[model samples]
Each structure stands twice: as structure tokens, then as C-alpha cells.
Target: MKLIGLVRSIRALGEVAEQGSFSAAAGVLGLTQSAVSQHIAALERETGLRLVDRGTRPMALTEAGHVLVRHGRTINARLEAAEQELAEIAGHRAGRLRFGSFPTALTTFVPAALGRLRTEHPTIVLTVVDDHMQGLVPRLTDGGLDLAVVYDHEALPAATTGPLRRVHLFDDPYRVILPARHRLARRRTALSLADLADEDWVGGHSGSAWFRIVRHACRAAGFDPRIQLSSDDYRAVQAFVAAGLGVALIPGLGLVSPTAGVEVRRLRAGAPVRRISVAHLDDEGQPPGVRAMIAILVDVTSHLRRAEPRRS
Candidate 1:
């Protein structure tokens, strides 16, 4: 078989393995089902082995099929990397980047960095996905995103066991949000986590990462927080605090605009900080657009760090 035909057949086999059916793979590859069947059939003829078990429902890849598909995926990834490098070498600014970020970062420095990127690379297309670390990490690993802005709290560290290359962005310190008229709001000294042990806590949904972080911080201070209210929205959590519902711990990025009737205060000790970073696949070299965006993010965060309010 010709090299081009062999590559196409391998790609078709990989897609079939992923999509689980010839028709599905056909749709994904923008080819007719008959054409997809011919490609696989050609591969089977060239390999002298049955690559797929047609007797199974949703299709099943034979042992030979699995081996070829695995190698095919690696080949595809390398080809993609080569294409990106060649584009940069040829001075092609026109490309698309799939970027992901958590909600707070999306609302904070991400937009500024994206705007700067657009100004500098006018021909580059941008697609942004807003998701939590749980969603973003998997996407990065599976090549669903080119880059992501992710964070992990000090109380509960992020998983670091993957093929992810991360660049430290900045630390977003967690602060106590209190009702303006609450007694703790009047304290001249910074309050410890233990000081709010008895207060009703407004927190993230039960069993969520943020909720776990809050529980871990409180337990470290020798108390189990009595979380009476829950919300995933940082703004809503601030609202609950302002209404005197309960005190909550919110990160600095989430407090870009503190709700009215709320007081933001620093922790005297053991403040939980969210360490933000830009992450990408380790095997893929940073394309020009990705590198440019990362640099812009660092610049934007530097200005934010300087302008952050000093709450004590």
C-alpha cells in the first residue's frame, strides 16, 4: 500500500476504535461508511490479519487493530507537533488555540491576556472553555485543549503525576469574607481560622474541591466548620456573608470586586493560598501562540499583584 493510503487507513482504524462503529467514524472523518470500510479492508489485506471483529456490536478492534491504533495515535500527535513547528518557522500567525480556564481566572486575568494576544496576533483564532480544574486537567491530558489556566489550593494540593508541563503564574491567597457589622469585622488584628470556628460557614457545595479545602483548613484549626449554606458562586457566597448568613473563605481572584456590606480580611496565620499555573502537554513544544499567551498572562498577573488591595 502507498504511504498516504496506509496513514489514512491507520487513522480510520483509530477513529473506529474511538467511535466504536464504522458509521460513527465515517461521520467524524467526514467520509462515507463505504469509504471507511474500504480503508480498513485495505489495511487488513496489507497486514494479512483481521483487524476488526465485525461479529461484535458497536464493533471491536482485534489484537492487531489495537497495536496499529496505538502507534497511529502517536504518529498523529507527532505530525500535529511538526505542523505547528513548521507553521511558526514559516511565519504563519494564522492558527487556532483552544484555551481553558476556571471561572474566576476567566473573569480575572485571562481576558486581559487574551485581549493582548489578539492585538499581537490578529490572524490567530481563539476558543475558550471555562471549567474547573477537574474538567480542565483531563482535557489537557487528552489533547482537548492546547493550554489551560489551572490552580490548586494549599490545603488540598493538585495532582502532579501526569505528563503536564506547568509554569507557575501566581498565588491567590484566601481571605475571610465577613459581614460589615459582624464582631469579627471589628477586630484590629488579623483573625485566625480558629476564631471563626463557631460561626456559621457559607461554602461551596458539599463534597466539592472548594468545600473539602474549607473543611481541611477548619479541621487544621481544631474545629469542624458548621456549613449552613452552600453555593458554587463566589459572588453569591459573598452575598450570603454580607447578609450575615455565615463567614466564608474566598480566594483573592474571586474577590476582584468585593460585594457591598462585606469585609475582606487577611488571615493572621495558616492562610490557604491557591497556586495558579499555566499547563500544557509536556511532549508538545510550545507553539508561538501558546508561548505568547503564557507570557501575556504573566504580565497581566504582575500588574494585578501590584494593584491588589492590602486587607488586614
Candidate 2:
């Protein structure tokens, strides 16, 4: 029998028990009294039990009728809930996307991209994680992350044999960050890498991707960086720059947007620019939503690239 048919019979039994009259139950169910009696009779024959106590003065349910009414209501409630969840999944109205990013990218670049995606696709849930390359690479390879924004220097760390693929988003040039009040900032112009050799430097952890990139840039420019303070936190470097503690070379991606309290100047001899890419497992065929997300990333990256002024 149709599930709705069973539900309707349970409703009839409940109303008959509550009102103690077939005519009253029919009025509540929007059916004629004869139709209500026929439905009750059909249910009684199907169950091989007399649901209504015909001997009673008004009409009332037998114990079997009461039991059917209770179970039917519970079944109807579960079916309704299941339908709602199925609809949500079908429409992509609710689901989660696990996203990961390196700390430096997460601070500025990732937020902008995610904000744009969220505003457009509010139903696509995102679980954002911030870790260095060492931590995130393993997770992405193990199928723990659906998407990742990874930072890659010239000499990136070794990769595990996980089925992941990458798309180049942008190559952001490194720049020199000096306090606004510093003499270099007064120039209001880009400075050569050699000009920055004598300054104190604030940096990230010794072995971090950013640390290696910055150190390499200084060495290529012909001097070792005089590191004054170092921490794993990228924001710490920004804070130190804002505090005039030292001058540091920062990746162009790190300056994706204007940050207060620090003066960002491009380097004449050029600093190391890291290649940031979006990666996902190759074997796990991306869902429609994930494909849509990749399209959004490509669109935003193109917009950012076009907005950049002619450097030559």
C-alpha cells in the first residue's frame, strides 16, 4: 500500500478516538462520513482486526488501532525528515568542503578567495585549516583535504606518492617590507636588494618555507640576512615590521591586499616569488561543487593578475 494511504488511515483512527464519532472524524479529515467508515473498514480488513469498538456508544479504537496510530505517526515523521535531507543534498544546499592552506596564504589570500566563494555559494560549507607545507601536504595526499592553497618556493620539500594534482594560481613576487617611518619608506620607491643588506631582519621559523625563500633572496643578492627575530608565525613577522623592529622580504602573495602599519616596496634586484597553487587528489573525481569552486579560484586569480600594474 502507498505510505500516504497508511498515514491517512492512522489519522482517521486518531480523529475517531479523539471525537468519539465517525461524522466528527470525517469533518476533521475533509471526507464524507461514509468515506471515513470505508477507510476504517479497509484498514480493519487489512490488519484482520476490528479497529473500532462497534459496541461502544460513540466510536473508539481497539487496542490494535491504538498501536497502529502510534507507529504510523513515528514512521511519517521519519519519512518527512529523510525527504528534507535528500532534497538538501540534491540541490547542493548543504554540504562541507574541507579546505587547507599555508599560514602565510591563509592570512590574506585565502580569506579573499573564500569570502568571494561564500558570498556566491553560501550552501557550500568550508572547513578551513592553516598549517605549514610540512603539515598540509600529508593531509592533502591522504584525502583529508578536498582543497588546498599551497605555497611553493624554488626548492620545495619532497612530496609523498599521493594522488594529488595542482593548478598554478599565481606567481607573486617577494617585496621588501619596512616600517612607514623608516628611511627606506621615506624614499617611497622600490629599493635594490643590495641596498637592504645592512638592515636588521624579522623572519619566520628557521626552516619554514618563507624563511628559506627570504634567505635565498638575500644570498642571491650577495649577503646573508641578519636575522633579528624569528618565529613560525607569519603574522609575527608583519607585527615586527609594523613595530619598526626590522626590515624583511615578504612574498608578493603575503601582500595580496593592503595591510596597515607596514610599507611594502618592490625590490629592484627582485626577491623570490613563490608559486601558489590549488591542489586536489587526481583519483578522486571532483564533485560538481568542487569543480565550481576551482572555476571561482581561476576567475579570481585572473582578476588579481589583470589588476596588477605593468611592472616593466
Candidate 3:
């Protein structure tokens, strides 16, 4: 039998053994149930031995099936290790890269990095999962994500650091937004929180990540911001600020487009900066694609940090 076909047949056999039914195995393999049945039938014809006890409720692997499955799993593991070794030498020549990231990054540096990765490794398949950092980390830990773009804040609870390696990328500082015609809009210097003590706040959702950061900073500055409207979308927040609804604090990543009537400025000091990182399984034997993705992330974020964005 051809090595590739033999591997697929063996993989299907093992999946059937673990799942207890051809239908379940088909679901896992993204194939029709009849395809799994055909693979098992072909294996039986090739081996001249019946491998399944189909009369049983969930089906059972026969003695021959069990033995083949045990050996097949070992073979599959070795093949995977060999593939990883070859990938390191060849640099993501063939394999799927499962990656994840938060929404803003998805729209920002992450997409550019993905474009470069596709250019460098055209044959590499990509699976992207876009979500919040809290949702993405667990997926990484549970083997769902091979690589992810995650962020950490010194003021916030640290990222979960077990069994995963985080490659530090860049710091995303929170910047202040003001109405274009507001008094502080003309100031070249970073604004102090006290500079807006009397202004209403157009902030993030009441209890969301950015909201908490803004609230904490305002408290540190000796006044609680009076939130007039809570909006998490940076564009909408900028629009609100432009209309003089209130001043707002937005992360640098979200400032890529500030709309027409809002001015962007830095916090003089004590601004919350989120550190971006590329995370992957640390147990080693990482796929070349994962490492390649990390390098791309670094390159993309570095450009983001250095580019002088045109003010809107």
C-alpha cells in the first residue's frame, strides 16, 4: 500500500476504534460515514481479516482490529514527529496552521502578518479563530490552537503561563480621545487625567476590560469619571467624543481610524499599556508553521509600533 493511503486508512481505523462508531469517526475526519466504512472495508480486503464486530450496538474492534490500532497509533505518532522534523528543515512546506487572536488585532497587525505568511508559505493552510484573549488562551491550553496572538497587561491579571510559551511582541499604550474642537485638542503634550476632571466620559462597556482600566486610572487620579455613554467600538467612541458627548480613552490599536472630528493624544503618565505576545504550546516539538507565524507577528507589530499613523 502507498504510505500516504496506508496512513490515512490506519488513522481512520484508529479513529473508529476510539469513537466506537464509523459515524463518529467520519465527523472527526470531515468525511461522510460511508467513506469511513469504505476505508475500513479496504483495510479488511488488504489485510484479509475482519477488523470490526459490526453487530454490536456501538461496534467493537475485533482482536485483529485492536492489534492493528495499537500499532497504527504508534506509527501515526512517529510519522507526526518525522513531519515536524522535516517541517523545521523545510519551513512550513505542508500542514495546517491553527491560529487565534483578539478582534482588534484581527483587523490590525494580525491580518498583515497573515498576508506575509501566505506569501512565504503558500501551501500552508490557515485556520483562524477570532475572539477575546480570555477565550483564546483556554483553546491554546486545550490543543485547539497551535498559535495565538495574546496580550498581557501589568495592571491586569497576568496571562496563564503554564505549558505555553509567550513571545513578547510590543506594548499597546492607551491614548486619550477628545473632541476636535475641544480645548485640549490643540495641546501637543500628553494629557493628565486631571486635565479632564470635569468632562463626561464616553467609555467602554461598564464592566469590560477597557472600562475597568479607565475606571482604575481615573480613581488613581483622584476622581471617578462620570460615564455619559458606554461604547466599546473605538470608531463609535470617537464619533461620540467628536460630537462632544464626552472624552474617551482608547488603545493605540483602536486609534488606527479616529473618524474626522476626534483628536488623539497620549496619557502623560500612568497609561495602561497592553503587551502583545505570540503564544504556542511550550512542550516543544513545535511545528515550523507555528514558529513562522510567531516571526511574522513580531515583524508586523514592529511596523505598527514604528509607523507614524496619519491623524484623522
Candidate 4:
């Protein structure tokens, strides 16, 4: 008469009959032993059948209980097969790679990575989206993305809870951007954080991840940087540095071309590094396409490391 009652009874009955002990069944199910006993008692009461003989040493199940247990196992197995078959059809043999990434990686890191993947897997489809770490974490959890490339920094705001796994790739170091005429620029070598303590600085918008990285790196070198200008755009930061206004900390990940007159100097001490990682939800069994994309990503990083020396 009661569908919910019957389902619960079947599950409890299957557990108790399989383990041969109410206490063992309850432990496996994370329920109290009394709850398991109560479920069995309720089943017998509702069906007007004696399901278990409690006087037996290892609690013998009656004929009705044995029948229900056998049928219950079959039902559970069929349900599992249905779900797995659906997932395989939906995800398997799909040539698409749904990748999410932040801006810095988008500028260069991902493009270079994709170039390498193309040579080996030319027919594989790739879909890429750019979003902040805070925005991407939710989409990753909700199944909107297959993988995400992100930069981890201590000062950045944390995202809400999500089911995902992070695979660390590498650390991208930050360099100081200065005018071609700055005294440190004439030195023709990387300058230490201590060497720039008294220098004026151009920075990103207040409370931005880059701003925090610059602030912390400076403080770690025993001085607070003087911010003369603030803007979120890297080009804007470059413009400020080019005019001899101030120097700013820039990451090496995307620093390919010069900014007309802007120059870059490596910071010897407290050269802040941002961690790059790939994120994906832990599905029970991953699809082949997902596995291929992961392989491509790892290969890309390996190739870049072996290439010519990059500007710090």
C-alpha cells in the first residue's frame, strides 16, 4: 500500500540478508542497528509475514525475505546499468573538449597549448570560455565545463564549494615593468625586490588579484610599494610604465611583446609566483575525449619547458 515503505523495507532487507547480521548491515549503511531492526520489523508487520527468525545464531531469513532480497539485487543492478549506459552514450566518443580558463592563460598559455593538441588530434573539437576564478568554479561544479585552467594566488577571493579536482601545472613568476629610462633599467639585469623599495609603482585596480600580489611581494621584501596609478587593464599598466610614471609587477605567462617603450626587469627576491592548475569534476569513469585533452595539456607544458629560454 505504501510505496516508500516498501522501497525502504526492500533495501534494509537486502542489506540484512546479505551481511547475515543486523549490526554488520547497519555499520555498512551508517545507520544504527536498532534502525535496521525496526525497518525489518515494520516490513513483517505490513506484509503479515515473518521475514526473519531472530532465534537463529546468524539470523536466518524466512522464505519471503529471501525472495525479496533476490529481487531487490536484480532491480538495483538494472538501475545501475541504465544510468551507466546513458552516461556512456552522452559522453563517450565525443570529439569535443569543453575548456574554461582565466585571461592570462587565454592570451598565450592556452593558444600555445591548443596548437600542440592540433598536430596530434586535428579532428577533436575544442570549445573555450574565459571567466574569473570566482565565476568559473560554479560552472565547473554544475557540469557546464569539462576542464578549467586557473591561477591560484593567496590574495584572490575563494570560490564557493564545488566538486572538482585540481591538477597543478606550473608556477608563472611575476616581473617588474619599468620605463626604458629608469635607473634600474640602465643596470641591464634583474633587480631585487629590495632594490625597488623606494621606487614609485603603477598598479592594477584596488583589491584586484594582481594588486594583492604586488602588495604582498613588496611587503615580503620589507617595504610597501607606492602606487601612483591604478587600472585593471594590463595595457593600461603598460601605458603607465612606458611614460616613466612608475613600475608595476607583471606575470611572465603572457609577457611576449614589448609595450613600445616599456621594459621588464626580473625581481631577484620575492618574485611572486602564481600557480597554474587544471580543474575537473571527479566523474566515476572519465570519457576518452577528456583523457585525450588531459594528455594534450601535459604535453604542451612539457614542450614549452624544453623550448628556448623565455624572458623572466
lDDT of each: 0.84, 0.75, 0.81, 0.76
Q: Count the backbone clashes (under 3 Å) in each candidate.
A: 0, 0, 0, 0
In model 1, what are the clashing residue pairs, if there are any? Answer: none
Once model 4 is optimally superposed onto the true structure by TM-score, how far is the C-alpha of residue 192 displaced, in angstroms? 1.7
TM-score of each: 0.76, 0.62, 0.67, 0.64
Q: What lDDT does candidate 4 reach at residue 193?
A: 89
lDDT of 1 by residue, 128-224 (tens): 9998777888777766688899876645545522458888788787899999999989987888998998899999997676887788888888998
**Candidate 2 global CA lDDT score:** 0.75
Candidate 3 achieves a global lDDT of 0.81
* Per-residue lDDT over 54-129 for candidate 4, one digit per residue giving the tens place of the 0 to 100 score: 8886778999889877776555544443454465577754365668888878887688777766767776667789
Report the C-alpha lDDT of model 2 over 238-293, residue by residue, as the tens digit: 78888989988777666666457898887765557776678877744465456766
Which residue pairs show collisions in model 3?
none
Which 10-residue window in model 1 sums to the lowest lDDT? 154-163
Ranking by TM-score: 1, 3, 4, 2
Q: Which of the predicted structures, 1 or 2, would earn the higher lDDT when compared with the native?
A: 1
Q: Assess candidate 2 and give its TM-score to the true structure.
A: 0.62
Assess the local accuracy of residue 282 in candidate 3 as a C-alpha lDDT between 0 and 100: 74
